[model samples]
Target chain A: MTGLADRRPEEDSVAMPRVSFTENLKRHVDCPPQDAAGGTVRAVLENVFADNPRLGTYVLDDQRRLRKHVTVFVNREMIADREGLSDAVGEGDEVFVFQALSGG
Target chain B: MTDAFHVATRKGLFRYERRNGGWQAGAPAFLGEPVSAVLTDPRDGAIYAALRLGHFGQKLHRSRDGGTSWEELEAPKFGAEPPPPSPANAENFEADMAARKAAQTVDTIWIMTAGGADQPGVLWAGTLPGALFKSKDHGESWSLVESLWNVPERAKWFGGGADLPGIHSVHVDPRDSAKLTVGVSCGGVWKSDDGGETWRQAGQGLRAAFLPPEMQYDPVSQDPHRLAHSGDTVWCQHHNGVFLSRDGGESFTEIEEAGPSVFGFAVATHPDDPESAWLVPGVKDETRVPVDGKFVVTRTRDGGKSFEALSNGLPDGPAWDLVYRHALDIDGTGERLVMGSTTGNCWLTEDGGDSWICVSTYLPPIAAVAWA
Candidate 1:
C-alpha cells in the first residue's frame, strides 16, 4: 500500500516520518504538530490531514485555508507564506508548528 | 486537593470542589470581608490579591503559601500622581462614586499580575476608558506603553465620545513571547506583533453582524483612514460571535452564531490546539440568558467551523447569569476551567466542563479569574 488511495494514511507506512523546524507564528497559544503530506511544510501538513481526518479539525476552518493560528515549519524554519505549501521534504528533517492565537 | 481553595462572600464564605458530578457548598464557609482580585502569580508562585482605588490608589497583596497567608504590598507613594478622576471628568460625581463603591474593580487583574511564559516580572494591565499600561519591574512601578494609547482606533472607541480605549484582556501567548492580543469592548481586538509597540485592530474574518442599523448606530463612522497594517488576517470576538479576520481588522466573518448568545463576553483559544477553543455565551443585555437557560462553556474543536455545548455539569436552575469574558479563564494546563460570576461565586470544572463545582464563593460576584 504505497498510499494516495486512502483518505487517511493508516495502512501505508512501516515507519513514522520525522522532521524538524522552528515556529515563528505571532501568538504562541497554538502548538502540537500533525502528520504532514510531503517534505515541504505545506505538503507535510496536508499529508497530516490526509492521514488523520481529525487533524483537519484543528488545522483548517470551514474555508480550508490554514486557520489563523496554525503555522507549519520545515527543518526548524517557519514557512512565512501560507498560500504556497506544496514544498518538498527531506528525510531526517524536523518540522516546527505554531498557532496564531492569543488570550490572557 | 478538595479544600485547597476558599472564598469570602457576602453571605459568609463558601469553599467547594469536584466531588462527583454536581456542586455543593460547604456547611461552614471561609469567612472574610471578601477579596476583589483572585490571581495566580507567576513571580511569587502563589495567588495574590489587590484593591483598585481610582488610578494610582492601589492596595496589593500576596499569599506566601498559596491562599493560606496574606500580606499587603505598600502602595507606591507617587509624589505627583495625577489627581483621582477630577471634577472635569465628573459631572455625575455622586452617582459615579456610588457605582464605584458597588462595582468590583481589582478582579479584572489577570493582565495586571505580570510575567508568564517568556516574560518575567512584566506587569501588563488593561483598564477602562480602555488604556494599556506595562511595568517591567513587576508591580513596584508602572508606565503606560505610551504609544498604544495614541493608536488611531482610540477615536472610534467609547461610542466615539473620546479617543481613548478600554483594554479589557491583555493575553500573551505562552508559546510565542512576541505575540499579544488585547480586546477593547465595543471597538474590537488589537494585536501587537512588535511586543506592544504599535497596535492595529485585527478585524479580518470578523463580522460586526449587528445589522446595518448597528453599524449606522456607531455614533461616529470609522473614518476610513489608511489603516497602517502589514497583514490582512485577524480574528475578533465582537459584540458578535467568534469572527475571523482574513484581512486584518478591515473585514471579518462571524464563526459562531448561537440563537441569541451573540453578545459573548469571553472567548478563549485552546492552549495546545488553536483549532480548538472555548467560549462562554451570555445574555445580550441581562434581560435573558443563553439558549436553554444554561451557562454553556461551548467548545469548538474544529476551530470556528463548529461548536458544541459543554454544559453537562453546569446547571439547569435559576443559577443562570451572564459570564463576563474576563470572568472566565483556563489554567496553563488547560485542564482546569474557572469563572467568577456576578452572582457572588466562582466555579471550577476539571473535566472540560463535564461538571462544575464552586471552588470559591461569597467573593462579590467575581469579575475576573486568573490562574498561572
Candidate 2:
C-alpha cells in the first residue's frame, strides 16, 4: 500500500498551487478551491480569473493592479510585489486572497 | 399591479409589487448584506444593488429579470493608486500614502441614478470618499469621473457620516444628458453643464450655520442632506433648512417655514410639478431623529412657502424613526409616494399625501427606495 507522503517525484511536476478565498469574498461569488497552473502569482490569479472573470474586478483596479485594501498571501506571507503580482509560487503552495477591510 | 418598486435595506433588497389594489413583498435578495443603494433603469428594466459587506468591502449586483436572480458585477473603483506623494507632501510621504490608500477603497455607494432615457447603457454612481463614477456599458463596467474628483474645492469638504465626504445624490437633467448635478454631504452641490467635463459649485444662497460667521454663505461648505430636481427647479433638504433653486441650481434660497423642523434626510419632488415636493421632517442636526418623537411628513404644493403635515395613517405615539436621504421617492405620475425610516418602517400614499398606508412594519433599516 502507498501512502500520500510516499508518492513524491512523479507527482511533483504535475502538482498545482491551491487557491482559496475568504468567506467574505465567497458571498459575492461562488469561490471553490481550485488547482491553478502557474509559476507566478499573477499567472495563478489569471488562471482563477479565467473561471470567474468578474472576481478580478473586485480584487484588481482598472489598471490591472491589486486594490489597496485587497491582500494576497502565498503560504501565509503577504505579497510584497504589487505592481506585477510576480511573486513566485511553488507546487502544493496555498494562495489566499482577501480584502483587508478594517473597523466597522 | 400598476407599479413595481424595490426597497434597499440594511439587511437586503426587497421587491414590492402592486397587484389588484394590494401590495406584496417579494423574496429578499442579498438576504443578509447591507444594501446601501439600489436603482432600476427605465430604459431597459435592469436592477442594480450596491452592498457593503463586513469583510468584502463594497460590491455591486445586477439583475435583468427584475430581482429574481442576480449577477455580481464590478463595483465602481478608483482607476489607480494615488500618484506617489506629491512634492508638497513628500516630507510626510508615509502619512500621505496612508491617506491616499483610504481614498481608494469605497466605503459605500451612497447614490445610484440611471442616465437619461437616450443613454441606454449609461448609469451614474456617487460613492463614499467623494467620487463620481459613470458606466457606459449598462452596469457592466465603470470609469471614475476624474474631472470632478480633481476639482480644487474638494479639499475643503469632509465626511458627514464616514471619515470621508460622500456624494449622496446625483440628479440628471430630464431634458439633456449633458447637464447633471450632484449633492454631497458636508460638501455642497456641484453641477456639470458639459456632461461632466467641467463642474462648478452651485450652492449660492445656501447657508451653513455651523460655519464661521464669514463663511456661513460659502457655497462649498453648505451640507445638502438631500437633493431633487424636477424640470428647471432644484430642491434641497439641507442640514440647516429647506432650500429651493428656481434657476436650475444657479442659486438657492432657504424656505424658512418648512414645518416641524427644517432638518430632514429625505426629499421628494413631483415628476412634472416643479413647485410640488415632500420631506420627512426630523429634529435638528444634533439629535437627528423625529421631532417630538413623532414621525411626520411635510408636503408643500406651493414650493415650500408653507408645508402641511401629512400623518393620516402614520404613528402619532412616541415614535422616533429617521428617514434617510435616499429612502423617499415619488413615482412618475407624482400621485404615489413612498418613504421608509431607519427604524424599519415604510409608509405609502396613493392620493398625493392626502392619506398614507403603512407598507411594512418590520424590515431591515431602510436605506433607499425607488419606483421600478
Candidate 3:
C-alpha cells in the first residue's frame, strides 16, 4: 500500500480536499485548515498526514489503516472502506475525521 | 527559582514552582485534557505528559523547555496481528483467538518513570491491559516490552478500574539500572533483574482480602494501589494494607499497624530515608474517603512498624478527599512532600509531615504528583 510519502501530484490539478479533525483531536495536535490533494480517501489522508506527520499515527495504526475509534466521513457519508481507505474522492470534497470522545 | 513539583490531574498538567518560600501553581498544559502521568527527566529537564482522550485513545507529549511548550509524539502501540487464515473451523479457532488477543490497543499510559542517572533517555511506561513500554529516545518513540507481557501469569490478570487490567507503577532500582520492578492493579509485584529480559512474580508474602482464603497468598492476584522505591526497599500501599520489601521485591511483609484505616491510594517514600514513607488513608475501598469524614495523612519513620496520622493544617471534619495512586510525592531533600486529592485539593509539607500547608484547593481531581 502506497503511503502519503510516495504520492506524486497529478499533472492535471485535482481539487484539494479540505480536511478537518474533531475538536478532541485538535486538543492534542495542531489542526488547522489545510487542503489535501488526492484521488482517493487514502491519498487525501496521506496528504493530510504529509503536512502533519504525527496526526497520522493518531488517526491510523502502524499498519497504515484507520484506527478503530477513528471515523472518517467524505462529504456527507462515512467512508465504507476502513482497511484500504480506498473510497474515491472528488474535487471540492470535504473530509471530516471524527474521534469519538465520550464516557469518563 | 526551581520548579520542584508537578501534578497530573483529570483536567491537565500543573507545575508547582518554588518561589520565595512557597510553591506557586503555573499555567496548565494540554488544558482540559486528562493527564494520567507526568515525569520530568532530571538528566535533561524534559517533561513527558501522558494524556488520555476518552475518544481518541492515549497520547504522549514532551516539553524540552520546562512546561513552556509541548510536542506530541508517538504513543506506545501494541503490535497488530494479521488476519486469520480462511476457513473458520475448529482447527484454527485457537489460533484465531490468540491473534485477536495480541492486538489490543493501549487505552491509557497509567504510569511513567524516568530511568536512572546513568541511563539517560531511557524511560519506562506502564499501560492499561497490563503492558510495559520502554523508550530510549526520551519520549520520542517506544517499543513494547514483550517479555513481561508474554508472562504466563498475565492471563489471569484483570483490571481493577476498567474491564482490562492496568499497570500503575514502574520502579527502576537507582543503584542498578537493569534491576526493575513493576506494580500492577489486580496483578502483583513483578521484578526483572536482567533488564527486562525475563520476569517473575515477586509478591510472595503480599495478601489480598478479596481472594479466597486458600488463594489469598497467590502471587499474581495481588492488587497494589501504589509502589514507592526508597533506597533498597520497595514500599507498597496495597488495596488491603501497606507492605514493605527490603530484598528487591523478592518478598513483602505486611505492616498491620501502618495506617488509620489501611485503605488508600497515594504513598510516597522519602528519597534518602528508606524508613520514612507517607500514605493518605481513606475509609475503605467501598466508602473511599477520610475515616469518619476527617482527612489525615499517615507517616511511618520506623519502616512501617507503626504509623502517625499527620493532620496539622488539613481539614478536620466532613472532608472526604480521596488521593489517587500517584498523587503523593516527596522532593529530593526528603523534607518537602506534596500531595493532591480527587477532591481537587493539594497540600505541601516542608518539614517532613510535621506540619502542612494548603497549596491549592480548587484545581482539578489530581491523578499523579511528582517531586522533580
**Cα RMSD to native, each candidate?**
25.9, 4.2, 4.9
Per-residue error for A87 in candidate 3, Å, reads: 6.6
Give the per-residue Cα lDDT of candidate 1 at A18: 47
What CA RMSD would candidate 3 show?
Answer: 4.9
Quote the lDDT for B175 in model 2: 92
Comparing 1 with 3 on TM-score, the higher-scoring candidate is: 3
Comparing 2 and 3 on DockQ, the stronger one: 3
Note the residue pairs that clash in candidate 2: none
**Could you tell which candidate, 2 or 3, scores higher by lDDT?**
2
TM-score of each: 0.57, 0.87, 0.87
| Candidate 1 lDDT by residue in tens digits, A1-104 | 12223325453353234432224321111334434436565566666556554444344432334444566666556665443344455644456654544310
Error of 1 at B188 (Å): 2.1
Interface RMSD of each: 21.1, 5.0, 4.0
Q: List residue ranges in candidate 3 displaced over 4 A.
A: A1-19, A31-47, A61-69, A79-94, A101-104, B1-3, B83-102
Clashing pairs in 3: A100-B55, A101-B55, B159-B165
Candidate 2 ranges with C-alpha deviation above 4 Å: A1-16, A36-47, A59-91, A97-104, B82-103
What TM-score applies to chain A of candidate 2? Answer: 0.82
